[model samples]
Target chain A: MKHAFLDEYSGLQSPMHRLDPRAKLVGLVALVVICVSTPPDLYAAFAAYLGLELILVLISRLPWKHVLGRMLIVLPFILVVAVFLPFFNKGGGSYNLGPFTVSAHGLLVLWNVAIKSTVSVLAVILLSSTTPFPELLKGLEKLRVPRLLTTIMSFMYRYIFVLSDELQRMRRARDSRGWSGKWLWQAKVIGHMIAALFLRSYERGERVYAAMLARGYDGGLRTIYLYDFGAVELGFVALVTLFPLAARLLAVG
Target chain B: MHIPDGFLNSGVSIATGVVAAGAVGYGLYKAREELDEKSVPMLALCAAFVFAAQMLNFPVAGGTSGHFLGGILAAVLLGPWLGSLVIALVLLVQCLGFADGGLTALGANVFNMAVIGTILSYYFFYGIKALLPKSRTAFLAATGAVAWLSVMLASGAAAVELAVSGTTPLSVTLPAMLGVHAIIGVGEAVITVLVVGTVLAVRPDLVKTYGYQPPVPRFEEAEVNQ
Candidate 1:
């Protein structure tokens, strides 16, 4: 039940950490959109975008290993998608690379997916590392995302740990009963465990509702005001937006 | 598989995004009618349970391990509407909080895993449940089969989206995704059957199929959840 820190680096003190969560949210989306929109041939722009990400990473002072590890999680999936692009893309000029006739445009598509996904995934890692989950949800709420969605997200974050603990206990109980699931028939027991977990969760949900009802949970949920973006935060937002635009303008299309 | 940004073009992203938003909006509207004040926490908690369960890697044949997708299980344990909404919200947390998936590509991801996963799985369960014998064993087998098929179908949906996005050609992407997911489907089915089967055996009332009741709690003596 050890909690993984999706926002592990959020508590660190730095300029990036201090920026308003909404600004960061909008800025991160802008970063991804700008990166994705840039043409594949714009290598210089891609390089500059990566540079911006590196600078943000340096400012946040998160462990390089951690950020790199996070990027690696999706790198393989992106690679899988990019791996086939060079082969099936029929519209491009062809080149003999030892055996396979690789298309030039296909190569460009590969480069497009590789570099863009790297930068985009990096930007996402930057956003998650910089902003705490609660603040991130509050940011979304402030940006006028539906109240119901935000409330669910908040509850999700809180209860994920408790439920994981329950799961671990079930696993331990199963192990104690000498069930290791080597045989196909063992799925029967695992089925029972999942059912047990669901029942417990259902019961817990009802209890949670009754408690909420006690405190007057009117159909809608509301949160008090606590976040504000100052002049400096606004400037940070402008910088993130402008950097990508600058790269787009400067990088040869 | 969680698709990142830049893999999809704007046209495809916007199209899927609109579909996803429309589904979410409809889900919220329906949930308001279907859910009592008590149901909201349950929905959120079940969503969190899915999140937690996903982290638990169960070892399959040979040496590799696989995680639970939980779309079918969620749809069966709760109804389809809430189940899909639960999964969609889980995607939001993963995308925004964990950066596991891209923000711009959220729509496509949700469309593939949540919308397609729940709707397809629920109907498959219903169709299969009708054909099977009226026994707990038959029900568990049907649930497992649906879970396995749900993964394949969801992956197929993603493959189509990727092909449509021109990220890769349909000829190449479809078979590749389907082949890889066919293996992942085994794990999904096993987990779903095990968990759902156990719940049915112990407390049939909690299983949320059309006929079975979900064991309403007696709230006369309300105790706070600690």
Candidate 2:
């Protein structure tokens, strides 16, 4: 029932955390766009990008272990998609590694996928780790995102843990009833559990609606609107912008 | 599966971004009719339930386990627009809050899993449901099979996006993605069927498939014309 998978280090105080969430959002988007647009063969630009990300990570005061650990979630997919690229690509001038021929261009493709994904993911990790989810949503709302989308996310953030706790209780109850069998046989029970959850959620929805109405709740969701923006945030955004630009120019030259 | 940033080229990413934005925009316009003051909470809660449900993992065969993608289940329960909207919200949170998907590649992730996955599964489930008898068993079976197919197609869509971006060759990426997803599809089928069957047992009315008009009988030509 206990989940800290989101914005775990948001409580930490640092320059990155203190910057306006919109700044982080916009800055990170620019960072990703820049990193993704760079050619893979430009190893120097990649290093500079990594350095830029590292500088931000260090400033953010998030644990390196946590940031690197999150990479595991994205790594396997990249490996699955790119691992064979080196072998399957029949580009001319390839080296023989084992039975399969690993092409130079193939290696470049692998490098492109791996490095670019890593850099962008790292930038994301830094951003999410530093910015709290609610502020992030507010930042998005500030940036002209659809109000409906933001409201939906607001509820998701609030009730995700509640529903997960309910799911946990249901699981415990099932386990307590000696509900142990191969899924092939016990699939029926799982199905019932899912149904029960849906029904419970539906009923809960009705109840929540009643409560909101009793309190004269309007349909719209509104959060207090103030993000502290000063010299530090602007300077931070400026540096993030400049680093990518400088790296690309150097990579091109 | 979440597509990471830079795995896709800029051109493909932008294209998918445009497509995804249009789909979500359309979904919003459509979903607004379904969402009201009372139903909005319910809808949001359903999205939360989906978020929670996605975390419940079941063993596939190995020590590894696969969680239900929830696209088809949501589509079957709450029409495709609401379903896609909920899944898109979930994907958005995972991308921003947990860094589960890429920021730049968020469009591709939503397009593949939410828009494509939910809409495609809904239509497929509808088609299969029409052919089968109007019974609970047929409904569950249709849901299971279509859920499996939906995941495979979504993965193929992602693979194609990657291929178009020149990230990987189509011949290599398409087969690889589909092959692994074929295994995942089995898990998706089992879980989707199990959940639909359970729900049908408890509250028959909650099954969205049942609320729609019955498929016209192929043998009864006169009834259809009337």
Candidate 3:
């Protein structure tokens, strides 16, 4: 019913939160590229990137716990990738742990992936925590993101919850009918359920199109609210644009 | 499965970004006629379903869990172009509002999950449906198979991107990604089939491609001989 999992923290206010969505979008992109492009061995650069991100996280006023918790979502995925690096990455320098050998090079690769991914993820969290979904869509559209795709995205964002509710209703109906889905043959029952869902969604699409036509929706879309690039937005963009260039220049120097 | 920013090299990410932008542009041009007023709300609802479905993570093997990608599911119900747009929106929202994905990596994520996953699966599913009976059952089976394959294919493409960027070697990443995702694909297939079937049963008119005539109907009796 209440899906606050997305945009949960977007209502909060801070300097970062006050910036334009497009500004945040561009800034975050610059930060990610800067952090990611640093070589694996550049521990100093990595530390700097982490510090920069930490500052932004604090500036955004999103709770540290929340950011860390969200970052953990990617941990399992990172582990899945990093776990095998010790075994497969053959470079040199082995350290004798208790039961097995840990390669020095493998550890560095792990650090490279783990840290970069975490920082990149944190940057994203900061951006999302500050920006609302509708404005974000509007930002993309204004950024020259194709309208077709944006329109599609806008609808999906709007209806994903509705579909979820539909699914729950279907599941409930089945359960009430004593459909436990415990046995292998019960799999067929699930199959039938799937078929039924498809049919419903299909029919809904046609009706939805008909409704659109009734509203005089022609092929072209004209938006009522035009996004203006304000001074604050410009300043935010300039600040973000400088960070990556500064980071790269510092690295080279 | 959306790879965030800094996951891949700038060259690769930018290249994929350009590709993603072009595909979306082409998709917009193609779907211009279909994106009229009536389709807007339905498209929105479909996007919401995908977003919700993604939140519910079903368990996979080895104590690992996977969520539905919903590309094929969206395509099967909304047609490929609209489906891809829906998924792209979901990803965009996740990045900007939910912070589920990276900002710079938005292009690559759209390419992997939205474009490749939806278009490829829809075409393949559509192709399969052409060979089978025009009944709902045939559509269900074909949708299931294509949905499964699409997930696997997206994973394969991701693995390639990682490998190309030298993030991880192909030998190590390929089998690990494929093996895990192959299992994940089963969940995808099941979800796709179940959702498609349910929609078909309740409101058959919602499916954009429903009642679409195949090159030749497989079963004579199944045909509505007016």
Two-chain DockQ for model 1: 0.49
lDDT tens string, model 1, B1-226? 6888878889988988998898888788777778855556977888888887787666666546667789998888787888898899889888876677777789989988888888667888999989988788888898888888989999898888878877788888889989988988887888787787667667777777836755677778777899
lDDT of 2 by residue, A1-253 (tens): 6777878898899989888998888877888888888888789988998998898888888898998898777887777888888787877589978877788888898888888889888888888899878888888988999887787777778888888889999999989999664454445666667767888888888888899888887888667966776787788788888888898898888
State the DockQ of every prediction. 0.49, 0.52, 0.38
lDDT of 3 by residue, A1-253 (tens): 5555666688887888777788887877777777777787766666777787788778888887888888876676676776677766777788877887888887777777788888788877877788776677777788886665666666665555666677778777877988544333235554454455444554576677677678887744666544456898887777666765576567766
- The reply for model 2, stretches above 4 Å from the true place, is A176-185, B212-226
Clashing pairs in 2: none
Q: Show the lowest summed lDDT stretch of 10 residues, model 3 chain B.
A: B56-65
TM-score-based ranking: 2, 1, 3
Q: What is the TM-score of chain B in candidate 2?
A: 0.89
Report how far off residue A101 is in candidate 1 (Å): 4.0
In model 1, the runs with Cα more than 4 Å from the true position are A172-189, A220-222, B131-138, B213-226
Task: Sort by lDDT, best first.
Answer: 2, 1, 3
Local distance difference test, each candidate: 0.81, 0.82, 0.72
TM-score of each: 0.91, 0.93, 0.83
Q: Model 3: how far is A185 from its true place, Å?
A: 6.0
